[model samples]
Target: DHHLNPCYVCNSTGHNCRALPRMRPRIPDDVSPTEITGNGLSETEPPVLEEEMEEPIGVEDTDFVLYVSAVETERCRRGLTVAYASHCQQESALDRPVAGHANFCPGELSTKYRDLPSVLSTVKHEMLHALGFSVSLFAFYRDDNGEPLTERRPDTGNPPLDEELQIHKWSSRVVKNITRKNWMIRGGFMERTFHMIVTPRVVKEVRNHFNCSTLEGAELEDQGGDGTALTHWEKRVFENEAMTGTHTQNSVFSRISFAMM
Candidate 1:
């Protein structure tokens, strides 16, 4: 479904895959590097890591992160979807011209939300999505040579959620190491699913606080429709988080989102 689409990964990085600058922005000193413990750590840790708990609101790294979704995203391929998170995952500063692409459903945005606050808010939401917040398409990020990017090692220091949504811990090796080269649902959902962001709190907030869904339990998304497999949070989680499948008045950008970029 992804072939020479309007990809943002290369645009944002300026085709840096051939030679990524050594002086990319460093992680801010205020944010601590992820700590390792005796937990079942491995080299397949997720690309994005935020706080131990909670999907913090409104954090972003604009350098390597950007937006583009004018293509075959999982949901509403040619619909009014706004944008998708897309970026390259080069193996190192000196790799071939490989580019990984991520896209969201296409949609005609409404004029009502075009004001500065609303526009910027929406951009914040999409930017975080590009950074891999609560997003599952990270499995497709590839190097310039069309090969899957390498995953970091020693999975460690993530907060825990229910079995269905274990954001902190990877459930399998495939999701951790495998790439979606030819297919989407590959390797027990480790690649097809987002194992970094958990929506338990958001789900609860939606179910209890915002009155979103009727179904109970920690099923992040409903049965499955319109490419809902691993691209979005349960529609009701956190009552319209920026990364949810649907957008609403309650949308709020997450802080944990910023760290992932």
Candidate 2:
């Protein structure tokens, strides 16, 4: 059986623990008002009826919750996917996720390979994706001061469209372009370009990791199409990092990943 525990209950730090705030669903503006009681009471009635008071909805006092489940899938058997995760709900006030879901494939959970380091790392990696590491959530990110990093529509509280009315999702504050050179077989040298996350903490950590003071930021994965591109670290640069697109033996949760968070 799968046993789950609240992180706040298991945390030893008590008040020092920085946790995600619980999100409350917003009520629709078009909701009709509650009907008054004893509306048709005669004027001759001796006693007047009091309107019943409605109790306010209470929200749980805890961090975000992640629901995990195991299932069988063809992708798992074909070695195409081991697990997948996504945020299911977001808090309107902060624009951050309050709940997420992760699905694990039973085929990849065989007794023989379940205990492997790579397998364990894959589980943690998927959990990270559920939390906030997603391209879809980038536009909702906020800065240290609780302000949105990307401009949003005041009415819908969502990212606004570009001049051409195209969906503009990525936050310019998070992603930037950097140019590099690649030696090609046919061409002597070619200018290769890709996007990178230039958040302050990410830039500091990556620059220190490579001991390059002039470096702009850490590179993001440009390959692997929609599933892998922009959402993960570049495989060639971060071969064994847990946030990379492909899992490798002895995968490590690097400090750079934490800095990105």
Candidate 3:
């Protein structure tokens, strides 16, 4: 899901995906004319009209009304918001030369990205980030005394048996203090502390899934672009894991990623 573009909702801040109702575009009545070409030829079978869908049953009202479009191609489809983008056509829309027409190629994904499953996985990955898989929730995971949100790790060290490690996990309670040991301290004793930015709950989920005690910071140790650095799963540790800054080919959302989302 290595989409360079940030989340359309929340503007790549990556919090509140599933909880956030998608913004229905304030569609303006004045639409630019749509140019059609040979591709608009009538199909052998006429298109199936949309069935009147019932409002989603038993879920929160936020669930969108998905108008199932019976199209043979992805180009005619809409994004997650389910907004209908009716393109208006003015006079002589067909007279324009198809050679220089850019609208014919209007797509965000092409080439290897055109694989439907891969595209869907990438959408899942982005949606996870939008729902706060890794974001500013770090502040919520610290106590007033500036300790991590977890209870004391029993003896402040390892347990005798591997089975005993489960006791070391986080308690149901959550607290945080941003005044000290926050994402700002990037060097010295606090260098690794950057990892705390993703709430300990998520870190705990990640650690438990991998059976690893040590969890660390942003995927890129070096500086990164707007979409990288603080906003991803550790790439080195979770290669091909969907939440990492750079999406891998054929990546699937890992269990830890799903839980955090």
Candidate 4:
């Protein structure tokens, strides 16, 4: 079954099939901060308030809007895969992890897609998966006392070093760009499965090959010449102190996920 492992691309419908139309991207319009509570407006009241209300006003006019996805859906229909919409919802999904499959299925699409914003996000998420850029596991690092390091605020002196941070930083960017859409799947056994598969390799590489102890003393070589690599003590510390924590599962996946991020 290893050879039979199905990727997301297996579901391509051929020539006779019609493509799924892309949904619109949600947009906002100029609306007063005061929300309208009226179920219906009177014909008599509208004319007098027209001068006071915002221009382009009408009885049925809405301030809500839908934008970008129409363009993407068209591209999908034409069999063109676009990668990396910078404004995509991948970051948002990372902030709020969810159970992917349980909440999302083709059958539930009808109800979910009724909400324009959700529809666009949902489509973009699936497209990311189809392209193989979805995040399987995401985590940051912590200090010796189990406090999460602030990657954002580097101004707070120095930060703890862990191989996971390096791998996560490198892999996250590569994975994000690999897809034309954004990733939405979060915190599930699927995420854990992916972590289990790749993390051990990362751990092994950090443990055996990357030398942190000699990083500082290792002289840097000329750019054109074969440069000497710097000694990195953090790598050794990570292996000895970070990796040896008391956990039932000593696997890299367990360590990283359970790290005090």
Q: Which has the greatest lDDT?
A: 2
TM, every model: 0.37, 0.70, 0.37, 0.19
Cα lDDT for residue 243, candidate 1: 54
lDDT tens digits, residue span 1-261, model 3 = 111111234323233333222222232234322422233313433323433323323323432221223233454243322111111111122211111101211244434746767556555554544343423332123443555454433432211222332112333343121223533444643423223333445557767766777743123222343335544666766788766665568686766665443
The TM-score leader among the candidates is 2
Clashing pairs in 2: none
Candidate 4: tens digits of C-alpha lDDT, residues 189-248: 222111121233233343344444322121111122111111111222333221222112
- lDDT (Cα, tens digit) per residue for candidate 1, span 1-261: 122222223343123333222221233344334532233223344233332322223223323423355554455444555554433432243322234444543354435645546555656665554455433444333343544443433331112223454222333321222233344344643333332232334334435543457523222444344434455555644456555666667567543233223
Model 3: how far is 19 from its true place, Å? 23
Score candidate 2 by lDDT: 0.71
lDDT per residue for candidate 2 within 26-142, as digits (tens), equals 333443334222433233332333432333342468567788888776545654667888887676688777778888887666466556766778789988888888877777777
Model 3 poorest 10 in a row by lDDT: 95-104
CA lDDT, every prediction?
Answer: 0.40, 0.71, 0.38, 0.27
| RMSD, one per candidate, in order | 19.8, 13.2, 18.5, 21.2
Clashes of 3: 2
Error of 4 at 260 (Å): 18
- The Cα error of candidate 4 at residue 150, in Å, is 9.4
What number of clashing residue pairs does each candidate have, in the order they appear?
Answer: 32, 0, 2, 10
Better of 1 and 4 by lDDT: 1
Q: Where's the lowest-lDDT run of ten residues in candidate 4? A: 224-233
